[model samples]
Target: GCLPISIIGLLVETTHLSLVTPVGWWLLVYSTVVQFCIAYVSWFAALARLPASVAAIGTMAVPVIGVVASAIALGEPLGAGQIAALVFTLAAVVLATR
Candidate 1:
C-alpha cells in the first residue's frame, strides 16, 4: 500500500509524468506489481506465523538467490566475491538451522 504509493509519488515527483503507464510497458509493470504484492503478502503471513530467528535465517538465501538468478537470467558475471558470499551464507544457514 504505502510502498507502491511512495514509489509512485517519487516517480511522479522526479519525472513529472502523469499517473499513466506507457502502453507497451503496462503489462510488464502490472506483472511486477502482482509479483510484489504476492511476495509481500506471503512474507507478512510467514512472519506472523514463524519465529523471528527462523524467518531471519530463511531470508539469508535471498541475496544468494538474487545473485545466481541475475547471473543466469541477465548474463551477469558472478564474481568470486559473490561466490564466496553465497557459500558463506549457505554454510551459515545450514549451521543456524541445525
Candidate 2:
C-alpha cells in the first residue's frame, strides 16, 4: 500500500539498492534514521543560533553532502562531471553563506 508511495519518496530508488537483502536494507534504514534524528536536532539548534536567511543559505550543502555520502557509502559512481558540479555547488554554497 504505502510501499509504492514511499518508493517515490526516495531520491535514488534504483538498481543499486536491489543488490542488498531485505534485512540488510532494514539495518541501513535504521542507521540512517538514527543519523537523521541526530542531524535534525543539530540542524534545529543551528537554526536557532543563526538567522533564518543564513540557515537557508547553509542548507544548500545538503545535496552536496548527499551526493558524497551516497557515492562513498553505496559505491555509486561520481563521475568527473558530477564531481565538478559538486565542487562548484559547494563553492557557491560557501559563498552564499558568507
Candidate 1 lDDT, 1-98, residue by residue in tens: 78999998887776534655697477767688988898889888889999877887758889888989999999999989889989999998998887
Steric clash count of candidate 2: 0
TM-score, cand. 2 vs. native = 0.56
What ranges in model 1 sit over 4 Å off? Answer: 1-32, 48-53
Q: Residue 7 of model 2: what lDDT? A: 84
Worst 10-residue stretch by lDDT in candidate 1? 15-24
Q: After superposition, how far is residue 33 of candidate 1 from its true place, in Å?
A: 3.3
lDDT of each: 0.84, 0.85
Best by lDDT: 2
lDDT of 2 by residue, 22-67 (tens): 9998888888898789888988998999988788775798888889
Please provide the root mean square deviation of candidate 2 (C-alpha atoms, Å).
6.0
Best by TM-score: 1
Q: What TM-score would each prediction reach against the true structure? A: 0.61, 0.56
| Candidate 1 colliding pairs | none
Shift of residue 91 alpha carbon in model 2, Å: 2.6
